[model samples]
Target: MSTAYGLTAVSLVVAATVLIGMFGLRISRTTSDFYVASRTVSPLRNASAIGGEYLSAASFLGIAGLILAYGADMLWLPVGWTGGYLVLLVLVSAPLRRSGAYTLPDFAEARLESMTVRRVTSVLAVLIGWLYLMPQLQSAGLVLRTAAGTPVWVGTVLVAVVVTINVLSGGMRSITMVQAFQYWLKLTALAVPVLFLLIAWRQDAAPGLGGDAPPTFPERTTVSIGTDVTVRVPAPVTVEVRGRVDGAGRAGPLTLTAGEHTVARDTVVTFPAGAAVPHVADLPVRTDAEWLRPLAGREYPMYATYSLILATFLGTMGLPHVLVRFYTNPDGRAARRTTVLVLGLLGAFYLLPALYGALGRIYAPELLMTGRTDAVVLTLPGRLIGGTLGDLLGALVTAGAVAAFLSTSSGLAVSVAGVIAQDLMHGGVRSFRVATLLALLVPLGLALSVRALAVADVVGLAFALAASTFCPLLVLGIWWRRLTVAGALAGLIVGGGLAGTAVAWTIIGGPPGGLAGALLAQPAAWTVPAAFAVMIGVSLITPRSVPAGVARTMVRLHTPETLAVDRGTWHPKGA
Candidate 1:
C-alpha cells in the first residue's frame, strides 16, 4: 500500500472530526451541554453516535485478527460483543438513563447515598477506562505502522492527541456528531473492501477452507519479521533469508527444521509457494479443519468460552459508551429505543470483520508466524486484490481504522475526564481539558510500554474487569432496594480486587499452563458470580446500613418521567 494514500486517508478523518467538533462547540455553552449534550439527542442520532463509540479497535481490527488466529470459536468475539449489547438493552439501558447521571460514579452516589461508594466507583471507572484505552492506542499504533512504516509510538501519540483535542473541544456534544459520522465511514470502509476481496478470492478458484492440511503460502511470499519471534513450523521448508535466524547472521538459502526457530528483528525470509506457514511459539498449531472447527485447538475451551460470554454479555454495561448513550438521550425511552437501533447498526458493522478474518486465513497465513495477527484486516485487501485498486481499498480501510480508535478513544477520554473534572478537580471546561490530557496520557504510556498481549485478549480482560467490578453494583443498586452502602463498597472492593489481580497476573505473566492459568486468564465466570453473591450476602447481613428513602429512590429509578412527578425536585443531597 502507498504511504501517501494511507496518510491522506488518516488526515481527512482527523480534519473531519475537528470540523464537526467545532460545530458542536458553538452550542456547548453549559456544563450539561458539554457533558450530555443537554439530553436532546434523538434516538437515531444517539444510536449512531454510540455505534461509533462502541465499535473500537476491537471491532474494526482486533476481532478479525483474533478470528484469523483462533478460528471459529473466536467468532464469539463478535457474537459476545453484539450479544453484550442485547444484554445492555434488556437490563441496563432504561434504568441507567432514568437515573439521570452523567457518569457511573454519579449514579453510584445518587442511588446508594454514600460518598465512599461514589469515590470507589469513580476510581474503578477511571481505572477501567484507562485499561480499555490502552488497546485502542495500541491498535492505532499497529494500523499506523502497517499503513505508513511510522514508528509504533507515532500512532499511539497521534490517537491520544486527536482524542484529547476532540474531547476538550466540545465534550459530549462535539463527539456525538463526530462519532456518528465515523460510524458510517467505518461501515463503508470495511464493507467496500470486502466486495473486491471476495471477487479476487473467487478469481483464484475459491480455495476450500475445510481441508485438514495446515494453511500454506498460496504463492511465493517474502515476509519481513518486524520484531524478534520464535516460530514453530509444522514441516521442514527451505527459505531465502536476508538477516539473522537462530542467532546466525547468514544471508542465503536456509532450511528451518520442523520445530521452534528464532527469527531476529528486521529479518526478511522468502518462502516458496505452498510452503507450510509457521506459527509463533504461543499460538496453537492446527490443520485447516482443526482451525475452522468450533472449540478446536483450545485449552479448556468450555471455561474460556463461558467466561468470555459472561465478560462480554455482562461487561458491556460497565463500559463508557453505554453510559454515553443514556446521558445524551432525552429520556429512558429514547435510550432504550436507541439501544434497539444500535443492535441493528452494530450487527451490520460486525458482519464485515468476520469476512476479513476468514479470508485472511486463506490469503495471509504469514501473520501467524509474526504473531501480528491484528494486522490481518489491513493486510488482507492489499494481498487479495493487488495493484492500484488494492492500494486505494487499503487506504480507505486505513481511514476506517483511524476512525475506529479515534471515535471510541474520544468517548473514553470524555467519560474519564468527566469524572476527573467533576469529582477530583473544579467544575469547568479548563478542568475538563486538563483531565482529558491526564486520562489519555496514562493509557498512552501503558500502550507504549506493553506490547505482548493480543489487542483482543487485552480488551477481553478489560471486559472481565468491568464485569466483575461494576455489573453487580449497577444491577443491585438499580433493582434491589435492599442494597446497602456497605454492600456496594464491599462488592466493589472484592470484585475489583479479584479481577484487577487477575488482569495484572495475565499482563505480567501468569502460570504457564493448566486450570489455574485458564481461570486467571478468563476470570469473569467465577469473579462475576462471586461479586454478586458477596454483594447480596453482605447487603442482607447489614440491612440497617441501607440508605434512607430507598423506596422513593427505587420508584424514581423504575418510574417513567411521563408519570405526574416532578423530575427535578429530588437531587442527591451533598452531591
Candidate 2:
C-alpha cells in the first residue's frame, strides 16, 4: 500500500518534461520562437502536443471518478469532453488558423476592427484561461497528497514553478516539444499498467473483486425527493422497509399487491435476498432518465442536458489554451490536421477512464462511502494488481496524472502570457515575462484557496464560460461579414456576464438542487444562445458598425489555400 513507486514515477515524469523543455530552450532564439515556435510545427508533432495539453486532470482522473460515483449516468462527462474536439475539427480549426491571428483576442480585433472588442475579449480570455488552469493545479495537489503523502499545496507549488520556468524561458516553442513528448509518456504510463493489470486479473482467476456485502435493497434504498421516496422494482418481493411522509408522521406496515405498489410514508416492509419484488407498473417510465439518474438521489432537470451539450460543443472552439495550440502550426492545413489527430488521441485516452470506472465499481465500491470517487481510478489500480506489479501500475497512473497537470498548466500560462504581452506590454519581451508570472499567480491563488472544488465541476464551469463568451465571437468573427464591433461587444457583455456570474455563484454559493442547481452547474444552454442572439440583434440595429474590410477579411479567412498561399501577402495582424 506504500506509494513510493507512484511518487517516484510522478517525479520522473516531471523531471523528464522539464529536461525536454530545457532542450527546446537551447534552440529557441527569436521572439517568434518563444510565442509560436516560429509557426513551424508539423501536423503530427503539433497533434501530439495538442493531445498532451488537452488531457488535463479532469480527463485523466475526474472522468473516471465521476463515473464511479454516478454510475452510467456520468458517461456524458467523457463523451462530451471528447466530442468537443470533433466540433473543433469540423467548425473552427481551419478557418481559425487562416485568420492569421495568434490568439482569440487577435482574431476578434482583426475581424471586428474594434479595439474595445479586442480588450474585452482579452479580459475574457484571461478569465477563461485562469478558470481552466485552477483544476489542473488543484488536481496536482490531489495527486501528490494521495500518492506521495505530500501536502496538498506542495504539488500545486511544484507544478506552478516548473510550468512557469518552461513558459517564461522558452514559451510555446519550448513547451511544444515537452508536451509532445509527455503525450507519449502519458500513453505509455497508462497503457502498460493496464495491460499488466488485466493479465494479473486473469491469472488470479478473477475473484469477486467487489465487496462481499450484497447489493442494497431497492425498496429500502430508494431515491428521496423532498418527502417522496421512489424505488425501481422489476418483480414481486417481500421486504422490511420503513418509509416516512411529511405531516403524516407515523410508522406503518404496508403489504403490496403483485402488479404495482405505492407505499405511503412511515411504512415498513421486510424481504430477504432472492425474494420476488413487485414491479412499479404505474409509475411513468423513462429509459433515458433512468440512465441519466444520479446514484445518490440527485436530480438534474431536462434543460440541464441541453446546457451540458451546448457547453461541450461550443466550449472547445473558444478555449484560449486550446486556441493557442492552433497558432503553433505552420499553416491552416497543419492546424486542420492537428485537430483531426487530436480527435483520435483524445478518443483513445478517454477509453481508459471508462474502464477504470467500471473496475472501481467491481473492486472498490467503498469509494462511494468516502465521497471522493475521483480517487477511484488512482486507488483501484493498487487493489486489482497487488504487490510489486500493483505498485508499479499505481506509479504509472501517477505519472499520467502528473503529465495531465503539467501539460494543461503550461498551455494556460502560455495563453495568459500572450494576451498580457500583446495588450498590456505592447508585445514587448519584458511584458511577456510579467504576464507569465501574473498568469501563474491567479490560478495558484485560486487553487490554494479552493482546494475542495470537484475537478469536473470546476472544469464544467470553465466550459460554460468559454461557450458563452468566446464561442460566438470566434464563430461569427470568422464566418460572418456582417459581424460588427457593437454586436461582438454586446454578445460578450451579455454572454460573458451571465456565464461569469454563474461561475461566481458556483464558487461562492454552491449548487443546491432542481432548476437553479442545473443552471449553476451548466449555464451554457441559455448563455450560448443569449450570446448569439445579442450579437445578431445588435448587429441588425447598427449595420454601419460593421468594419469596411469585412468582405476582404472573410475572403481571406475562407479562400482556397493555393490562392492565399500564392499571394504571399497574408501576415498575422500583430506580426
Top of the candidates by TM-score: 1
lDDT of each: 0.87, 0.75
Clashing pairs in 1: none
Off by over 4 Å in 1: 566-575
Backbone clashes counted, model 2: 20
Give residue 269's lDDT in candidate 2 (0 to 100).
47
The clash numbers for all candidates, in the given order, read 0, 20
Task: RMSD for all candidates, in order, please.
Answer: 1.4, 8.2
Q: Model 1, residue 514: displacement in angstroms?
A: 1.8
**For residues 227-338, what per-residue lDDT tens digits would candidate 2 score against the true structure?**
1233444444444446642224333443343443444533444554433332222122223234234442235635665677789888988888888889877677778888
lDDT of 1 by residue, 315-375 (tens): 9999865675687888888888999999899999999988998899999999999899999
